[model samples]
Target: MKITVLSDTHMPRMSKEWPAPLLQDIQDSDLIFHAGDWSDISVYEELTSMGKVHGVTGNTDLTMIRGILPEQTIIEAGGKRFGLVHGHHGKGSTEANAIAAFSGEQVDCIIFGHSHIPLLKQDGKCLLFNPGSPTDKRRQPQYSHGVITIDGDIHAEHVFYDSKS
Candidate 1:
């Protein structure tokens, strides 16, 4: 199953809209995972037009968005367990601490976002991902989104779309 991973989309604030290519990918995906910092619940609703969305609340998300998405969510995708969080618990302050909290949850991967930094890393036995920001591309030049391929070999890729265009 191919999963579309997105994060730090500040909606009307960050970027005007989701990239057309990413939106198309979402429609073609088996599932959609949003890391956090959506800033608005409407963003989730809009994204749902693409596919099934599983997400968490980021630091910038309002109370309502928080009500909808948990601080962390554990779900099964592509025959593997995944833990998705907003990473507001300290910009991934301690990987061990975050993983420890999710240790007994039976997860094979951990997906999180915050700091508007994109990351695709293998931490020990799990894959940790941060999809960066499609809008908040301050730190890095890559205004990006993420794609996770789970059919044969588990893989994570960040697709940096030109924000200017």
Candidate 2:
């Protein structure tokens, strides 16, 4: 399975449409994960039109978004358990909060977004991934998103680019 992960799009607020470079990845993905802060329902609608999307609602998400999406959830993909969260609920750094979100759960990976910083590392037996904002890179040097491919084993990587246009 091929999964595309992203967060903090803040769409329409960031751009009227998906970034041109990111579009190809999104289109090629078998599944999509949006960690949150979409800011507009159209972003969700558009992603769904392209493929399956599993997402959480961020602290900044509109009420309509919060009403439909959960704050956090776990999904099973390619025989691996993935814990997903927007990472704004607890009293700590976003990374810490995300890890805590599934403290008692048995997840192979924990995916989150809130700070718009791309990170991919191993935390014991689990993988931690944050696919930074393609539209809102913040202090990062480049716009980025993530791709996770699962065959016999799982592998994840960031796709960075210089432009969001």
Candidate 3:
């Protein structure tokens, strides 16, 4: 299964629509995961047109987004468990907080966003992945997202580009 991962889109605040690269990835994937900060529910509707979407709500999300998405979620695909979170705990580092969110959980991977800083690393028994922000890169030089291919094992990769569209 090929899963496209993204987060912190921030919608009209960041861009008018999905970035070209990310849109293509969404079209070419088996599933899509948004770690949150979408800001608008229209973003969710747009993504659903491409494929199945699994997501969480972020601190910046409004009532509609929060009503539809959870603070965190767990999904099983290709025999692997994925934990998704926005990592905005109204506190410290997003990465560290994300890890803590899934602490003691039985997940093979923890996917999160909130910092707009791309990250991919192993944390104890789980793979810690942050797809960054495709439409809102913040101070980062490139806009980015992630793709996870699951065969017999799980493989996660970050896809970065110089432009959002």
Q: Which candidate is the best by lDDT?
A: 2
Per-residue lDDT value at 94 in model 3: 89
Task: Point out the higher-scoring one by TM-score: 1 or 2.
Answer: 2
Q: Per-residue lDDT of 100-155 in model 1, one digit per residue for the tens?
A: 65866777788887767787788777888778777778879778888999975679
For residues 1-165, could you state the per-residue lDDT of candidate 2 as single tens digits? Answer: 899999999999887877776788887888999999999988998889999999999989999998989999999999999999999989999999999999999999999999999999999999999999999999999999999999967799999988888
Per-residue CA lDDT of candidate 3, range 88-148, in tens?
Answer: 8846788889988987789999999999999999987789999999998889999999999
Return the candidate ranking by lDDT, descending: 2, 3, 1
lDDT of 3 at 130: 96
lDDT, each prediction: 0.80, 0.93, 0.91
The residue pairs that clash in candidate 2, if any, are none
- The whole-model C-alpha lDDT of candidate 3 against the native structure comes to 0.91
Better of 2 and 3 by TM-score: 2
Model 2 CA lDDT for position 143: 92
User: How many clashes would you count in candidate 1?
Assistant: 0
Clash pairs of candidate 1?
Answer: none
Deviating ranges (above 4 Å) for candidate 2:
none
